[model samples]
Target: MFLLWFLACGLVDAEGEPRIEAHRCAAGYYPENSATGCAKALEAGFGTLEFDLVLTRDDVAVIHHDPFVNPEICTLADGTRLGEEEADRVYFKDITAAEARAGYLCGGIEVEDFPTQALVDEPIMTWAELLDMIEGHPDVYLHIDIKWEGDLSRPPDTYARVVMEEFWARELPNDYYVSAEYPEPLQEVEKLDSSVVTSWSWPSFPDGESTTLVAIGHELQTTLGTEDLVQLANDAKVDELNIPWQVADRRRVEDAVASGLPIQLWTLNTAAGLEAFGKWPVEALITDYPAGDAP
Candidate 1:
């Protein structure tokens, strides 16, 4: 079933148009990672939805972009605002899924960068809840970005097992893939279930334009020839490469195509970006404004 769906995804690239994956559930139109945003994206005809995942204290997966609740966009359950320092102390790993849903509300304030985002108060969503919402939309593909930044308690292998267990239990019909900046989590996922598809997300550059990272280690990868980067991804056993648009030059994209591995670009929201990157023969373009007229 997934094989057929993946082939259909490739057909989009064959038509010279990269499939658009809604980043954070069309965050430019709705609140980032909110259930409302996800529903809106599906309503707006998005075939692919990308979201972040983090485990709660009880090892339940929840949809959230950050490890900690951000005071800038979230408020307490009683509608009380939280200070940045206070919000920082509330880590997802430290709270149970029930506590996360009942103790806080996100999307109360607009993200400064997304000027047109709708301001709607919403609770955090469990992985089960998200799956239920999208059950009717089986054609929709999911790009799950795992967030495990060096937490000793939740090692990469443990994280992969927990997430894969939840996924296997659901027996979802929709096609999906897992992605992470570091390859350990993806490698572990492959070890757990070789049938599952995994994407290797490249760390962002130091300009801070991207959310993932901007370390010296990534600088080396970006500086390397496209073949070398593709070889590295092959070594990691990732099925695809999720790259930042800033460094996805024409030559590099062409080289990746020659290597026969699909490349997906991220966070492209502008008309110019869509116009420019759309010319590349990549597999998908992830954007915050999938419902907008930009693409």
Candidate 2:
């Protein structure tokens, strides 16, 4: 099925359209990181799918954006909704995957940000499960963002090894790249296998105020200059640059492009955003609304 799609419409064609990566598996239309959401994104014609990966206490990698299950999008197995305080205490690193699957059901709640997302009850998926689901879509590309909390998570080497093991075990024909904001995990991946492609994401703020254009622009100007960030990617031997849309100004985009590596701008869901950033020669645009047309 995917082979025919790939042959019919490759990511880039004669028209030179930028490839679309389904961010969090089309989070705007379906539950973020859920299997249903991922399948829908593929069915919707998104060749590349992006999602997050975190490890359980048993060293099993799971498809979850945060280290802890988000209360806003999940409910307890017994049908009780989780509150912020209670959910914060339940870390993936402290529980086994079976315990997580048996203890909680994710999705069904309406996410305030994703107004159009459908409500569906589903279990948290494991890395193996995700691989199995995409088996039929052999040509689909994967953009895996590894998640971990500082000090509270396992060692970077261990985490990287586990993720790599899962990939090796499957040995599927899909083209994929793994990424992390910090360089340690990617560095560990390089050590394990230099052949694997990796990307480095930058400009993450410690104060959690990194979302807006102003804050990200300020950080780029002051502490995390684009030149320096590109040099950091070089030092880490990363194959691509995964940059936030807000900070991907003309200068930063040029700097990343100057590095001769592919640049992927993320989470641009609006037509205005697509129009603004589309002028740049980015390799791909990661978005929650892959089916949205830019006017």
The 10-residue segment of model 1 with minimum total lDDT is 204-213
Off by over 4 Å in 1: 1-15, 85-87, 204-227
Q: Give the TM-score of each candidate.
A: 0.86, 0.87
Candidate 2 has a TM-score of 0.87
In model 2, the number of clashes is 0
Candidate 2 local lDDT, residue 77: 89
lDDT score, residue 261, model 1?
Answer: 82
Model 1: per-residue Cα lDDT over 17-136, one tens digit each: 898999999888889889998888887779899988888888888888777777888899998887777434578888889999999999978687888788899899888888778877
Please estimate how well model 1 matches the true structure, expressed as its whole-model Cα lDDT: 0.80
lDDT (C-alpha, whole model) for all candidates: 0.80, 0.80
Per-residue lDDT, model 1, residue 19, is 88
